[model samples]
Target: MRWILLAISLLPHSLFAEVADVDLNEVSEQQNAMKINKCCEDNELMVDSVCRLVEQYNQSAWIPKFKTEDGKDTKVKHYRFINGIPRCETTQQRPIFDLGKSEDQLNMLSDGRLLHLIHHKHSTEDIKEDLSNNIYSIHENIALPEEREPASYIYEQDKYCMDKILLSNSNITGVYALICVPEVKINWRDTDFILKKILNPLFHAIAMVLFLLEAIIYFVLPTLRDLAGNIITTISVCLIVSQAADLVRIFTEFSNHVSFMITDIILYISLLGAFFWLNSFGFYIWKTFKSRNVFLRVTDVRKYCYYSAVVWSTVIMMAALAICAHFLLDTGTNPNRKMRSHFSSSIIDNDIEQETIGWLGIAIFFTPIAFTIIFNVFFYVTTLKVIKRINIYGRIHYKLKGCFDLFLQLSLIMTIAWLFLLLSWLNFDGLIYAHIVVNLLQAILVFYVCVVRQSHVTFLLRKSCCYAEPVPTGEWGDEMTHMNGGNY
Candidate 1:
C-alpha cells in the first residue's frame, strides 16, 4: 500500500519526464539540418538524418569516431558540419537548416547559395512556461509550415535543414539533447509485488507441504503405499533451491550490487540442485523397472549417477563463470572507437577458440539443453509406443515417470525462451514480453504441479511394481521379454 501510494505521488513527474523526451526529439529535429556522416557512405543525406534523429530519440550512447590519418576526433567538431554534404559522385544537395545565426549578411556563397544558421537561447523560465501552457500537446508548436513567402521561406528552410536538432553548440556535434530522468515509482498494487515475491515461494511451498504430507503417510498411513513420496521429496528440494535462487535474483536487482562471483556461485548451486534432482527422478524410474531381487543394487547405482551429475554440474558451473568472465573482460576493456570492430572480430575469433578450450563449458551449458529437447521428443515417442504395449500398471508408471514432469516441461519451455533471448540479446526485440511470458508460465506450471500431487497414486503403484520384479542384481530388467511374466 505504501509503495502504491508512493508511485501515485510520483505519477505527475513521470508523465512530465515522458513529455520532456518528446519535446527533446522535436527540438532536435528542428536543429539538425543535414545528415551524412563517415559512418555511412552511399546512403542518402535524409537517411543519415533520419538515422540520427531516431538514434537520438532512442538514447544511443555517443560513439567516438577518430581520424587515424589526421590524429583528430572528427566526430565532435567537423562531422556535424560535413554530415549533410553529398558525395562527390552524387548530384543530390542536402537541405541545410539555418539557425538564424546572422541576419545582416545574407548573400550567396562560393557554392552559389547562402545559408544562415539559427541559434536560440533557451531559459528555464521559458521551458516552465511552455510546460505550464501545455505546448507539448499542440501539434504546430514546433512543426514547420508547408508554405511560406520567398525570403521568409528561405529563412525557415535554412533554419532547419535536417529533421530535428534539439541542441547544438561549438563543442556538441549533431543534435545533443537532455532528457529529464524520471523518478523511480514502484507500485505494490499496480506492479505485482505480491506476484513477484510470492509466486516462486508458492511453488516451493506446495512442494514442501506435499513432501511433508508424503513423509507423514510413510509413517502413519499403512496403505498409502507409493514412490510418489520419494519423487515429491526430490522435486520439493529442487523447487526450494529454485525459489532460493529467485529470491537472490530479486535481491540483486533491487539491493546494492554484489560481485559477479557471488551471483555465479548462487546460480551454480541452484542449477546444480535442479539438474541433479531431475536426474535423480530419472534414476528412480530406472530403479523401478529393475528386477525385485536386484532393486537394492540398481537403486544404489542410480543414486551414484544422480550424485555424480550434481558434482559435475557444480564443476561446470565454475567453468561457465570463467567463460562468461572471459567474454565480459574482452568486451569491457576497449574504448568506444574500437568497440564495433573489436566485438565483430571477437565473435569470429572466439567462436573458433572457445569451441576447443571452452568445450567443457559449452557442453555443460548445452548438453542438458540439447538433451532436453531430445528427451522430450523421446518421451513423447516412447510414451506413445509404450502406451500400446503396456498394461495398466505400466501405463501408470509411464504417466508418472518424472515426479515433476509438468514443472520440468515448464522449465524446459523457459529454457527455450531463455535460449532465444540469449541469441537475440545483441538486438533484442520484445524482450520484456518474452520475459513476462516465460516467468508467468513457469510460475503457473510449477504451482499447478505442486498443488495437484495431494491425491496422485500413479507414482505409488510404479514403486510397488519396481520392487516386485525378479532377476540377478547386475542383469536386472535386461530383457523386456521377461516382462510378460506379470512380475511388474
Candidate 2:
C-alpha cells in the first residue's frame, strides 16, 4: 500500500498542474513553427544543398588555377567545365604520342569513351600502361582505378589496330586528353588560306615583276638617270631582292638548317633596306625643297654618296645585331643543333624555340624600320609645307606639281601599309587581310605613279630605239629655281 501511494505521488504533479487557464494561441504558435526561406543570387544556383556559382560564372572568373606537384599554384591558360568540374586544357610538356603522327587516329565515341587506333607493335597492356602512366604524370589530380581495363578492338586488314586501346574515364574529356595536339591545319577552302597563301603569293609575284620593269626604266633610261632616279632605282633594287628572298622562303623547302637561316637573314636585311632607302628618299625630297640651289647639281653626287654610306652602314649594323641576338640572346643551347633536330624530326618544342629566335630577329629588324617610317612622315609633312608655299606663290610648274602629288600619294600608301603590317604582327586578325591587300596594291600604285603617269617616262618608252626629240627640262629646272629662292 506504501509503494502504490509513492507511485501516485510521483505522477500527480503534471496531471494536477494543467487544470489552470490554458492559452490556445500559444499552443497553436508552438505547433506551427516559423521556417527560414533560402535564396540564391543571379549567378548562384543551389548545388548539393549549397549556393554555388554556375558553370559560366566560374569559367569567366579570371584564369583557372591548379596546384602543381611542388604545392605551388600554377596558372592554366585555358580550361573547360565538364560535369560541373573544371579541367585544364594545357599542352603537356612531354606528350605520350606524336601528335603530328597520330593525326585522325584519336576519336571520341558517343558514350564518352576514347578510341585510339595506333600502329605500334606493342602489346595492348603495355600501351595502356604507358598511356596511363604518362597521363598521371601530366595531370596529378586525375585518379584512375587499378582494376580498370580498357576495351580493345582488332582491325585485321590494316594491322593499325594492334593496340586499339579504348580509354574510359569520367574525368578525361576529349579536350583534356588531346590538349597536346597542335591547332588544326588551315582549311584549303577557307578564306584566310585562299587570301594569305594563294592570292598573297600570286600578287607578290606580280608586284615583283612590275617592280623589275620599273627598276629597268629608272636605271636604263638616260633621261631618268638623275640623282632622284638613282635613289628610286636603289629602292626598287632593295624591294626586288626582298621579294625574291620571300618567294624562295615560300616556295622552296630548305633541307639544310644553315640555308634556311641565311635565307631568313637575307630577307630581313633586304626588307629593312627597302624602308631605309625610302626614308632616305623622303629626306632627299625635303632637303631638295629646302636647298638654296636650283636643280640637283653635280655637287649633289657627293651628298648621294654620303647617303648611301650611312644607309648601307646602318643596315649592316642592324643585320649584325639581329644575328647576335638570334644566336647569343636566344636559348643558351646550340641553335644550329636544335634547328637541325627540328628540321629532321619536326619536334614541337624545338619548333617553338626556332619561332622564338625568328621573332627576336623580327623585333630587332622592325625597330629601326618603324623609326624610319616615323621620320619619313616628318619629312613628308615638311616637304608638303614647302610645296604649298611654292604653290601659293605660283612658282610650281604643272608637271612638277603633278610629280609631287604622286610622290606624296606613294609615300602615304607605304606608310599606311607598314602600319598595318605592324598591326598584323601584333595579332590583329582583321588587320592581316588589310595588310596583305595594301602591300599588294602598293607595287601597282608605285608603277602607275612613277612610270605610266609620268609624262617623261612615257616619252622615253615611246622613243625607245629612235633618237627622240629633246625632252623639256624647264619644268624640273623651274621647280628647283623656286625651291632655291630664285625666279620660277
Candidate 3:
C-alpha cells in the first residue's frame, strides 16, 4: 500500500528537473522566443529571425522520415539537439516554420556543421534508421520535450545524427525539433509497463519459485544430485539471479546509477551458465543412451568445484574487460554516449563499434557462445541418431518412447528459444516478439519438464494430495532415469 501510494504521488509530478516545470519568471522561461542556432554552406547569410507564432500553439506532432523503411513515415516522441541547425538539405534552404517569428540580422559565417539530439528510446538494430533526409518534410524543427516520464528508457549511443529533429513542448507534441536532454518515465498503470515489467517479472518470478521448489525436492533425495541435476540446478540459479536483477533494473528508477553494474555482471554469468550447462545436458543425454544405464559415476566435489572456478573465472574476466571498454571509450557529454549492456548478445547489430563500446565485449563474449551453439546442435542431433540406432534392438513401442523422451529433453533445454534468437539474428521481421516470449518462459518450461513431470515428484504429489503416508525411497520407480534417462 505504501509503495502504491508513493507511485501515485510521483505520477502527478513530472520528474524533469527544471525544463518542463520551470518558473515562468526564470531566465530560460522568460526568453519565450524559441532559441536555436542555424548555419549552412558557404555564402549563407546570418539567420536573425525567431518564430513568435509558436508561443500560442495548442497541439502538434513530429513526423520523422525513416531511412530503414522506404517511403514510410515514422513518428518520434522526442529529440535532443546539442548544437545543430534544423534545415532542409534537399532545397539548400534553412527550415522556416509556418508559425510566427521575427528575423533579426547579425554578422556570422556559414559553417556546415550541426548537432542533433535523438530519441530517448534507443532503437533495435533491425528497426533503427537515420531520418535526417526526411527532416524537411515536417514543419516544426524542434524536438518535443517529454510530457511524462516514460518507463524503461533505453538510449544507446550506437550513433545519433542531428539531421533528424522532432520537437515538443509542455502541451503540444512537436513535429521535428531537437531537444537538449530527456528523461524516461515508467508508470505503474501504463499497459506497456505492465506487460514488460509487471507481468514479465511475474513469469520470471514464477520460474524462480518453481526452481526453488524443485531444488528442495532434489535436496531431500540426495541421490538425485547427479551431473545432469547439478547442471540443471546451476542453470536455475543463474536464471533466478538474472531475472531478479532484471526485476530490480526495470522497477527501480535509480538502480542504474549503482545496482546496474551488478546486473551487467550477472547477465554474463547467466549467459555462460546457460551455455556450459546446456552442453553438459546434451552430453548427459548422449552418455545415458550409449551406456544404457540411468546412473553415471558422479565426479567428486573438489573436481566439480575446480571446474566451476575455471568457468566463473573466465566469465568474470570477460565481463571485467567489457567494464573496461565501458569506461575507456565512453567519452562524451551526452548521457546516451556510453557503453550499454545489451551489446553482450552475440548479434552483430549490437556490435555497433561506431556508436558503443561493443567491439571488445562482443569479441570476448560471443566467441565461446558461437562454439557453444554449434556443439550443442551437434550433440542434440547425434543423440537423436544414437537413440534411433539403439531403438533398432528394442521393441517398437520402446523405440517410439525413447524418441519422445529425447524430444522432451530438447524442450527442457530450450531449443525453441535458440531457434527464435537465430531467426531474430537473421532479421526475420516480426520475430522479436516470439524471441522474447520463448526466452522469458525458459525456466518455467525447464521446471515442468525436469521436475513436475518426474515420476517421483508426481508420485509424491499424488500421495500428499491424497492424504496418504510418505513412500519409502526403496519403492521409488526407476530412480536411475531422473529425466533424460528416466525410462531406463
Candidate 4:
C-alpha cells in the first residue's frame, strides 16, 4: 500500500494543471458578519484563546461610599476591576474600565467580571462587596501544597481583637486558628462617678463663684489687698483654675473613661496650683511664729515674692518629674488606663487614677497635698505654742487673741475635712459618701470662715463698699500692716 501511494504521488503534475484552484477567498457575507459579532478584539486577561470580560459601572460598585465619624461622606477605595482585570485600588487615580461598552448585557455580567473563565460578582452592597477578595483568595489556593507560596499583596481582617473575617479558601481555612485575645476589663468607681459628674462640678462651680467674689473684694479695695489679701488672691486664682478644669472635664468628651495625657497634664497643673497656695499659707504661719509679730511691711512683701518664686519653681520641676515617671511606668497592672482611640501605645490616663493610688497620683498630686496638710497642722500647733509662750513670758496681746482663736477653729475644720478624705481610701463605702460631702462643701466651709466668721475678711468686704473706716476692734485694723511685716 505504501509503494502504490508513493507511485501515485510521483505522477507528473501537468496531468491536472487545468483543474481550477479552490477559491478560499470567497467566504460568505454571513460568515464574515458572524466573525465580527463573536470575536473579542481587545481583552485584558486572555488565556487558552478565551477572552475575559467585566462590567464597567458608571456608578461606583467596587469603591463604596461611606460616612466618616467627622461627618464627611466619601468613597472607600478598596477594590478595582479595569478591563476585566480584578485589582486592589492602590493607585491614586484610575480610569474607567468599560463604560457605555455594553447595552443590554444579555450575555454579559452586571457588577461582575469574568477572570480565567470564572465569574466574580462585585458590588458596594451586601455579599457582593467581597467578590474580588473571595476570588483572589480562591486563586491563592491553586498553589501546590508543597510548592513556594505566592507572596500576597493583601491581607484579610484580623480574626482576634476585631470582627471575624473568615475567607473561603482552602489555604486560609485549613491553616487558620482562632486565637483568644487577652482583653482587659475595667471597673468604674460608682461613688467617684457621682462625685466626678455631679458633686465635684458643683463644688468647683461654688468655689469659683466664691473665689471671684473674694478676688473682687480684694482687688477693688487697695487697703484690703494686703499680705493675706495677696495670698488670698493667689488661692482664688488656683481654685478658679482647678474648678474650671473640672467643669471642662465634665462637659467635654474627657468625660469618657479613657485616659488622656493632655487632660492629665491640665488636671495636675491645677492640682499643683492648689497645693502651691496651700504651702504658701503654711509659710505665712511659719513666718508668724518665727517673727513673733503680726505685722509686715512693703519690703517684707517683696522678700516673700522672691520666696514664692523659689517655692513654685521647685513645685513645677517636681510636677514635670512625676509626669515623666508616669510616662515611663507600666500601664498593665494597677488601675489600667489605656487610651480609647489607640492600641499598644502609652498615654496618660489620669492625674489621679480614681480606681487606685497610682504612682503618678501619689508623686504628683496626692502625696504633695498630704504633706502640705500635715505641715499646716504643724504650723497651727507651733503658732499656738508660741502664743502660749508669749502669754507665759509677757502680756497676752488682746488684739491678736481673737484672730488666734478663729484661726484655730478654721484649721481644725480643714484638718478634719482632709482626714476624712484620707480615711475614705479604706474602701468603706460609707466613708466615700462622707468624703464627698466634706470635700464638696469646701467652698461653703471657706465662705463661712473667711467671709462670714473671720473679722478681718468681713472687715475687708465691708471696707470695699466705702464704709466708714473704724480702727478694727480685734486689732484687725492693723491686720494688713502686720501681715505685710510692719508695725501696727
Candidate 5:
C-alpha cells in the first residue's frame, strides 16, 4: 500500500518532467545525460561565483575554469538558451545551434523562447563532449534513411559554407555551425509572420527607387554640351546596370523562397549586367580619348599607331570574358540562401558545372593580366603625348583635357588595385586588409574624379570671368550689371 501511494505521488511530477528525447536507450545518451545534469546542477549552485567572474568582463560573461579542445584551460563566454526559448537578453545572441543542451532548450529556442543551457565563459572537456554529442544528435538524420540521396545535393552544404557572399549590405565569406538542435515543432509567432511579410515589400520599394534614380540621371538630366552629356550618359549606364542587378538579386531572394527556378536564372543574369557596368566605364574613357586625340588631332601625337577600333574591340572581348568568369566562379553556392534553388545542382552537377565554369574564369583572369600590360603601356604613352601637346598649345585651362587626365589617373589607380587583388587571391587570409585598401582607393579616386571635376569647372568659370572683364573694376558699373544678369 505504501509503494502504491509513493508511485501515485511521483506520477504528477513525472508527467511535467522534460525528457531530452524519447529514445534515451542509447548508451551515450544515458551516460552523457546523467553526467551533464550533474554538471549543470553544480553550475546552478555556483551561480554567485560565476556571476562574480562574469561581472569582471564587459564583452562576455566568464565561465568557470575549464579545459579546452587542446586540453588547456581557456576563458571564453559560452552561450546557451535556458528552457529552449530565448529571453529578451538571450535572443540577441540568436544562437542558431546548441553545441549540446537537452532537447527542451532546442525546442524553446526554435519556438521563440530564449531557453538555452549556457556554460558561461570557460572551456572544458566535459562541455566539449556534451556539445559534440548534441551536434551528433541533431545532424544524425541529415542523410535520410532508405532513400537514395539526390546527386545534386551531394556537396550542396559544403559549397554553401565555402562560397563568398554578399549579405544584407555586408559581405559574409563563411558561416560556422556552432550548435545543432533537432527540428523543433512549434507554432509560429505574430512577429515572425510580420517580419516575413514586410521583407518582400521593402525589397520591392528599394528596387523601384534604384530604377527611378537611374531614369532621372540617364534620361531627364539636362546636358550642357555633348561631352558632358556623353559622360553623364556613361555614368548613368553604369548605375543602371549595377542597380538593375541589385533589383534582380532582391527579387530572386523572394522568388527562390517561393520555389521559382526561372527567377534564379534571371538572378544569374545580374552577373552579366555587372560586367557590362565595368565595361561601360572603360568604354567611356576610351571613347573620350579617341574622339579628342586620334580623330580631332587635339594632341600632337602622330608617331605610334593607336587604333580606337582595336582598343574598343579589346574592351568588348574583356567584358564578355568577365561575364563568363562570374558564371564559372559560381561564388554563390548557399542552398539555404534565399533565391537559390536548394537543388540547383540537380539540373547540372555543381562540381562539373563549377569546373566547366572555372575554365572560363582562368581564361578571363589571365586575359586581364595580358590586357593590363599591353593597354596600360599604350594608355600611359598616349597620356604623356597628350600632356606634351597641351603644353605646346598653351591651353593652361583646358577643361576637357583636365577632365580626361582625372579619368585616366583614376583608371590607372583602379587597375593597380585590381593587380594587387590578383596577387592576394592566392593567400585569402589577407583578403580583409586587401578589400579595405581597394575600397579606400576606389573612394578617393571617385571623389577626385567626380567632386574635383565640379571644383575645376567652378575655378575655370572664375578664371574666364577675370579675363573677360578687367577684374570687375572694383566699382561695379556695366561689369557688375552683366554679372547680375542686367538686373540693375
Candidate 6:
C-alpha cells in the first residue's frame, strides 16, 4: 500500500511539470504578439511582417480643396515636392466678353481682392474675393496698379508694372485670362552673397595685388633671376591670372556664353598652373637637397626648361580633361549649381546637363590638385628627414639651412591652404569661412617667407640700397655666382 502511494505522488509531480511548460510557452507567444503589434507606430504600417513608413501620408489632403466661386477649373502654375510631400497653388481665371477691347482690366483691390472688369454697352464686373494667400500676400503692403496690364501689352509697350504680377490670356479661350503671382519674394537678401560677393572677392583682390608685386620684384631684380626665383615668379603669375579671373567672374556679368566658357577654362588652367608650379618648387628642393656634391650649382637652365614643360603640359591636359568631362559625363547633380546660377547672371536652361558638367569640372580640377599636394607633402617629409640628419651632425651651413627653412615654410603654407580648400568642399558648416581666411592670408605669408625673411633677398636689397657691404664668399654669393654661371 505504501509503494502505491509513492507512485501516485510521482505521477502528480510529472503532470504538474507538463502543465508549467505549457503555461510558459503560452506566455512567450503572448509576449511576441505584443511586441509585433508595438513595433509599428501610428504613421507606420506592417508589410511582410515588418514595420515601414507610409510614404504617401499627406496631412494637407484632409483640408478642404480650394475652388473659385465661378466653378471654373483652376490652373496649376507651378508645383514642387518638399520632403516627398507635394505642394501646389492654382491661379484663378476671369473671363472678358470682348476680345478686341484694349481696356479690359484686372486689378488688385486694397484688401488683396482681384477686381475683373469687362467693357461693353453695359459693363460687367466680377470681384474674386478669395486669392491664394501664398501668392498675393507679398503685395499686400505695396500699392499695386488699379488696372493690371496684359503681359503682351507690357512687353510690346515697355510699361512699368508691379514686380511679381503678370497677366496673360488663357490658352483655352482668348477672352478668359489668368494672373500669375509668385509664391515667394524675389528681392529677399541671400546670405550666400555675403561670402561670394563681399568676402571671397575682397580677399582674392588683396592676394592678387600681393602676387603682382612679388612677380614684379622677381622679374625686375637681377639678383632674383635664378632658377628658384624664376619658379617663384611663374607661381606668382599663375596666381595673379587665377585671382583676376575669379574676380571678373564675381563682379562682371557674362552676357555671352562662349566668353564665359573661355574665362572659366582660363581660370581652371591658371589655378592648376599655380599648384603645379608649387609642386615643381618642392621637386626642385628635393633634388637639390638629395645631391651628393655640395659644390654643385643649384641653377640649371635645361632643368628649369624641363620643369616648365612638364608643369604647363600637365596643367593644359588636366584642363582639357575637365572640359571633355563637362561635355560627356551625365552622372548625379551638383548641389551648388543652383547657387552659382542664382548669383551669376548666366542662366542654366538644362538642369541635368549643367549639373553633370559642374560636378565633372569640380572632379577634374580638384583631383590633380589633391595629388600635387600629396606629392609635395612626401617630398617635404623626405627633405626634412635629410635636413634633420644634417642638423644633428652640424655639417650644414647656416645659409643652406635658411634656404631649406624657407622652402619648408612655403610648402607648409601651400599644403595647409589647399587642404583646407579641399575640406571646404565637404560642405561642413564654417569650413568655408576657415578656407577663405587661410587662403586670404596665404599671399602675405608667402611674401613674408619668400621675400622679407629670405637672406638672399635682404642681402641683395641691402647691397642695392647701400645699407651694407656685400659679403664675398658667403651663402648668397655662392648661389648667385653659380646661378649666373648656369644662366650664361
| TM per candidate | 0.37, 0.53, 0.49, 0.49, 0.35, 0.53
What are the per-model numbers of colliding residue pairs?
A: 32, 0, 43, 11, 25, 0
How would you encode candidate 4's per-residue C-alpha lDDT over 1-488 as one tens digit per residue? 99998778866554454332323323333233211011222322222123333232111112222333332554432322222221223211111111111110111112121111112222223223332333322221111333232221111112111011112232221111111111222334554555545665677677789877766765555554545556656666766775675456443223234334555566556666656666666566556556845455545368558757976786688677777667566343322232221111111121222222244544666677768777767777787777677633322244335445545555566557657756765545567667657765776776676567755566555554556654343424545544544434
Backbone clash pairs in model 2 (N, Cα, C under 3 Å; residues 3+ apart or in different chains), count? 0
Q: Across residues 392-427, which tens digit of lDDT does each residue of candidate 3 receive?
A: 443322432443463446444565665665565443
RMSD of 5: 19.5
lDDT of 5 by residue, 1-488 (tens): 99999999998777655353344545444444311111122122112111122232222221223333233444433322221211222111112222224121221111122222322232244345544444222211122333332221111111111101112222211111212122222224543322323433343345445434433432332222233333433443443443344334332222312333332223323323323333343444445555544345443122111332443466456556655555645454322322211211112210111012233444553555455545645655675565555543312224345445655654565456556645643433345245434534543454445434554333323534554522222222323333355444
List where candidate 4 sits over 4 angstroms from the true fold: 1-200, 251-259, 292-300, 330-358, 392-433, 466-488
Tell me the tens digit of each residue's lDDT in model 6 across 200-237: 78899899988988888767667566567788899889
Local distance difference test values of all predictions, in order: 0.37, 0.54, 0.44, 0.44, 0.34, 0.53
Q: For candidate 2, report its TM-score.
A: 0.53
lDDT, candidate 5, equals: 0.34
Which residue segments of model 5 deviate by more than 4 Å? 1-221, 228-356, 365-373, 390-397, 420-427, 440-444, 456-488
- Model 2 clash pairs are none
Candidate 4: residue 327 lDDT (0-100): 57
Task: Flag the better candidate by lDDT, 4 or 6.
Answer: 6
RMSD (CA, Å), each prediction: 22.8, 23.8, 18.8, 20.0, 19.5, 25.0
